[model samples]
Target chain A: MDFLTILNNSAAEILSPSTAAFALATIGLNVHFGYSGLLNFGQAAFMAVGAYAFAIFTMQVDPTATLGWPMWLSFVVAVLVAIVAAVAFALVLGIPTLRLRGDYLAIVTIAAAEIIRFTVRTSDYSAVTGGSQGLRGQDYKGDITGLNPLTGTTYGFGPWTGTAYDTWIRILAWTLVVVALILVWLLMRSPWGRVIKGIREDEDAVRSLGKNVYSYKMQALVLGGVLGGLAGIMYVLPRAVQPDNFATAMTFYIWTALLLGGAATVFGPLLGSILFWVLLAFTGGMLSGLQQIGAFGDMSGTQAGQLRFVLVGVALMLLVIFRPQGILGNKKELSFHV
Target chain B: MSETTTDGTAPTATHPLVDGEVAPGCKKVDPIVVADGVIRQFGGLTAVDVEHVEIPRGAITALIGPNGAGKTTFFNLLTGFDRPNKGSWSFEGQSLAHVPSHKVARRGMVRTFQLTKSLGRLTVLQNMLLGARDQRGESFFAALVRPLWRAQEQSNTEKADSLLARFKLDTKREDYAASLSGGQRKLLEMARALMSDPTLVMLDEPMAGVNPALTQSLLDHVKGLKDDGMTVLFVEHDMHMVRHISDWVIVMAEGRIVAEGPPETIMQNQAVVDAYLGAHHDTDLGTLTNQQVAQIHEAAEEEVPVGLEASATETTTTDAPAEPGATAHDEEGKR
Candidate 1:
């Protein structure tokens, strides 16, 4: 309940693998909503596909499991499978919805994400998907941890300290985030980016210019979703792969992070994700410390735990009102649209 | 043939534009685009029902009509922006019916929107660059490696720069297209369309919101397209612009082609005079007498006004009314 301990806990969230995962996912959402003007409200579905495909496929390498694939082969195939699944999801979602107006995509994506959650949680596919309780992290984390190069009990210094496994996961998660950032940066400056941005402004105009607007949009959707899938894998790396984790609220949280950082900007997602988690952790720590000291007059830990999100909601509203274009977005470019 | 272009070239389509008698659905000496039975209906309203239309290659053909005449809808159908009830169209002799707008453009036919659809958030240069065809950098995988597309990007930038310079938009290249004036945006849109070196150009109301002086420059640019041997088809309410720049004019009324001919004779066409154009179609709005103005208003009360129905037909060098004596000089100078 010490204030120093509270501050330390909040700071630790900045470098947490969870922060990296959300950052990666928000970057994917940025590609969807920010650059392409696509409203993908089912980003969590893309993440879910990644997590499930990776966990299920990697689990196949277990000697007792079916197929009994080699560990190395399973590792490579799991990543590839995640990517392919994300693409298939994109094609399915985009073929019918991309031609429609922007709002339709938003509706379809949100519905699709929910459908994915429900379908996976249903008892019918419980053996493969692990049902509502979901697959345990220990089942599949072994491959990634097996591949980890770090060989120390503990790592890092001071407030950023973590076990070697934690350090390895952070490295893996951030490396993916950096790669995605670089890819997005390169794309936005190219003629491909110009065409995409033009579609954002007006598809008719881009179409008149002879660029395949639909193809470009599909490409963006798949690329962003693949990144989302990777983020999904990252999200569950340090914990369990619960079906409830990829619920509608997860998609909304990614959106909040994207808007907070700047939807169209290169570093906006990373910044937004860091700020969102750090603030959430900080507020949660403060509230619980107060609760332990009887500040809420016998407020239960569960009740205090939920209060931090209320503060986050308030912060998000304030952020939207004051800086809707986000920290890094150009006011002239995205202020009206964002 | 002696008509000097802005860049000192002669007009390419000087021999003859039509194969026979000038009429609705008339055969062109060389048509870049040919359409038949393009019927588009909006529930109770028939938007466009052009039975046959041919756009002359390497010449500026003006498509003019009053409000609700379906000129834009026909433009949409031909450019593959809208679907027709039943129609067959060919661009450069290849059938293009049901082709998407981008494919229609890829066939070397590009269009500009009547509302001037400039990508507002994009820089003026970026807007122009988006019009370039076969851009290697525009492919998703190719975009990642700068080396793969750097040479093409450089060449494209150069081409874009020259087009911007030609449109007099070079100064605003780095500025976002949204920040441009209405006239500048029109100019930018036209320049962007030219980036692909299209064989056919379709413009919808390029002069609707432009200033008159800019209209004059836009007139020169359209003329320049013919000099470069690119076919130009445009929708314009500005009778003056249509008469000055267009080599041929096609008039539409109530979703059908009413008449087609050179603009000099279009005014004298009996069918055009009755079905659509006002008697004072050629008269400058600034020069209209109070009685003539009242007649236009009176006509509006009865039905759609022949001349006054056009929005901003008088956008010119000055909003100040022209002196009575200047009208003759203005008409003569345009001729």
Candidate 2:
């Protein structure tokens, strides 16, 4: 029942790799749904591809489980494979569907995500993807942590304490987030970005202006998908590459973070992700404390966990009702009709 | 009436559609767009069926017809916005049968929407910038490196600024297009279309929903295109605007060219009047005042052909000619 411990845990969660992963994913979602008016409901699929590609590439090439490639080569190859997988996904989904408008992309993307999850979780792909048991991060965690520049054995004071390895992961995750933000900002300010925004507003008008709307849409899909892939790679660095981690609910969480921050704004996703994690941590900690003190009568830890989601849902509904444009989104730019 | 080409470029034999003897579907002296056997059908209905038609170069031409007469559909077909089932059209001697809309626009034929698609979310200036052709900044990789397209962007911005000034929308350049009034939206759309510097500018109902205050400016803009050596093809229901600015007029009725003439002769043509008034033209006279009714009857008596009234009465049960508001029905019927 120590309140200081709870406060410390929440603070630590704010800087955790999980927040970074969601932030990165949300930024990609911003490109697809916010700026381009593309409905990509399978962002989780891109993350799964990235995580599995990295895991399968780095794992030992044994009959029981992996390729066992050199750590450095596997890391680079994993990123490339993730990018290829994302582009392939975009082409397969976008080719027949970009020409048609509304809800089709949502349906296809969600179905694709579910398909990826089910395929990887099956027994057939167990050798490469580790099936439901999942790929152990302990095998390659050292490959990444070994590159840490920090000299200290344990970093940070009391409440924010973390080993140098943990610090390295946080630094790498934040670095990726910064790079993504810069890239997104630069693109949005450019003429290409202008056209993307125009497509979101009225694609026919853009087409009439001599632009290839289909090509632009494909580009957006690939770019956003690649970011989702990167997020997936970052996500598995501090945890096991479980097929369950990249679930449908992961996409919903990313979307919540995106909407909370402001869909189209550059800083919206980053801030939204941080806020989302911090709030979740704070509420969970508070609920656990209350349950320990018998304030909830007979409510167990599982019920408390369920209630945390209910509170977040209520908060999201209130935000949407009060500000449909999101925290930083312009009301004029929110043409959901498109 | 004396046969005169509005642009006064050259005098050819007078066609029957005009004061001259050029019949329907006849060639023009200096045609910019030539369509031969262009047909667009939606299900069983034929939306556009132009056997042969030529839009005169360097002059303002009007495409007028009753509601659902396929004026807009023809525009769509010619501009590559919509495909024709069976037809070939060429702009400036180049075949544009299967060309995409953007490519057609790049080849100096650009169009504006009838409903005024102003990209409500984008600022006025952004809308204008979207019109400029061959934009280097439009490339994905090039956009990342600003220096590659910065100069061109500056030039585009300058051009947009001047056009915005001309359209008197400079003050609202940063404002979202949705904030503009309906009339202002039309003006912004026209200004945006000019960014391409197209040789052929096709306007679809440019005056629809426009305020009276802006109508004169819009007319002047239409006339200015011709003065600048550009071909102007417009679809409009405002007869006065048609007669005032158009050098030549092509009239469509039931997806066919019923008449092609100068504005003066078009108003007097029996087919043109019948297309406007419909088959029950005389029966609806009760809605008119005494003087108006007298004028209509007098005109009908002078213009209605022998035994034409009997035939008109026989077909009263058929669908009436489309009115301005009936355009949606016409499009649906075509499908």
iRMS for all predictions?
A: 1.7, 1.9
Worst 10-residue stretch by lDDT in candidate 1 chain A? A60-69
**CAPRI classification of candidate 1:** medium
The most accurate candidate by lDDT is: 1
Candidate 1 residues A188-248, lDDT tens each? 9887888888898998899998888889899999989999999999999989999999988
B1-335: candidate 1 lDDT, tens digit per residue = 23312221122222267776567888989888898998999998998989999988888899998899999999898888889999898988999999998889998989998998989988898988888889888888899889998998889999999988888889998998888889998889989999999899888998997887787888898899899989899999899998899888898988999888777667666667766756576656567789998998887787755455333344442243374544654566689
Position B295, candidate 1: lDDT: 96
How far residue A76's Cα lies from its native spot in candidate 1, in Å, is 1.5
Task: List DockQ, one per candidate, in order.
Answer: 0.50, 0.47
Would you list the C-alpha lDDT of every candidate in the order shown? 0.86, 0.85
Clashes of 1: 1
Q: Which portions of model 1 show Cα errors greater than 4 Å?
A: A60-70, A334-338, B1-15, B277-335
Taking the tens digit of each residue's C-alpha lDDT, what string does model 2 give over A1-338? 77887888888877888789889999999999989999999999999987887667656532123555454555666568777877787788899889888578889999999999999999888877788988889865655655567988998776557788887888888899999999999999999999999999888888888899999999998899889988998999988989998899999989999999999899999988998998898899999988889889999988877788999999999999988777887776555333
